[model samples]
Target: MEWLARVMGARRAIEVGTFTGYSALCLARGLGPQGRLLCLDINEDWTHVARTYWRKAGVADRIALRLGPAATTLATLPQEPGFDLGFIDADKENGRLYYEEVLARLRPGGVLILDNVLWGGKVVERRQHPGDTSLQAICELNDFAAADERVQPAFLPLGDGLLLLRKR
Candidate 1:
C-alpha cells in the first residue's frame, strides 16, 4: 500500500474501515509530511486502539478518525474530486454503496481497494445460504466492477480477495 501510494503520488486519502489502524499506519508511512488521512468507523472502542497506535507511531497528527455510519459520513463529504486514494473495508452489505461514493470522490487515476470481497470463498459457491446476504452483496460488487468501464478493475485472490480499481 505504501509503495502504491508513493508511486501514485497520493497525498490525501480516506479509509472506510479502521479496525485497529494497522492499514492506516502502513499508508501513513508512505505519505509525505503534509499528507493527511481520514479514517471512518462506527466503533469508538476499536478506533481508540487505533488512536493509541497512531500516537505511538507518531502519526496521530496525520490521521483523523470520524465515528459515525460510514455512508452518512461519506455522503456529508463535498461531492468534488479531492481524495487521491480510498480503502473500503467496512460492512459487507454496504460495500457497493461505499464503492460508488468513494469512486465519485476519487481524483483521476485514484486507487480504491475493497477488502474481504470473497466472503470466505462463498462468492463461488453454487448453493446459497440464509445468511448469505453479505456474500451476495460482495458478488454483486465484483460483477459491478468487472462490468464498469469507468475504471480498470482486477479481482485478486489475495487476503480473502481484493477488488482493486484504478479510476479512469
Candidate 2:
C-alpha cells in the first residue's frame, strides 16, 4: 500500500478502516511531506494504540483520526473528486456502499483499494449459504467493479484478495 501511494505521488488520502494504524502508517509514510491522511474507525481503544504508533513513526501530524461509523464520516465530506488514494477494509456488509462513496470522491487517475474481497475463500464456495451477507456483498462488489466503466481494476489474489481500482 505504501509503495502504491509513493508511486502515485499521493497528496491526499483516506482510509475507511484503521485497525491499530498499521496500514495508515504505511500510507502516511508513502505520502508526500505535505500530504494528509484521514482515518475513520469506530473503536477508540484500538485507535488509541494506533495513535501511539503513528506518533512513534513521526507521521502523527499528517493523519487525522475520526472516531465514528465510517459511512457517516465519508458522507460528511464533499461529493466532488478530491482524494488521490483510498483504502477500504471496514464492514463487509457495506462494501458496495463504501465503494460508491469513495469512488465518487476519488479524482480521476486515483486508486481505490478494497481489502478482504475473498472472504477466506468463501466467495468461491460451491454452495454459498444464503444468510452470509458479507460474502454476498463481496461477490457483488467484485462483479460491480468488473463491469463498472469508471475504473480499471486489477484483482490480485494476494492474501485474501486485494482489488485495486484505478479511476479513469
Off by over 4 Å in 1: none
Best by lDDT: 2
In angstroms, the error of model 2 at 46 is 1.0
User: What lDDT tens digits, residue by residue, belong to model 1 across residues 1-168?
Assistant: 777778888999999999999999878866767789999999989999999999999889889889999999999999998899899998888988999999999998888988887788777782665578888788888889899898999778888988879999
- Relative to the unseen true structure, what is the C-alpha lDDT of residue 76 in candidate 1, on a scale of 0 to 100? 96
Pairs of colliding residues, candidate 2: none
Model 2 misplaced regions, further than 4 Å: none
Task: State the lDDT of candidate 2 residue by residue for 86-148, as single tens digits.
Answer: 999999888888999999999999999999988899888815566888888888889899899
Model 1's alpha-carbon lDDT is 0.88
Cα lDDT of candidate 2 equals: 0.93
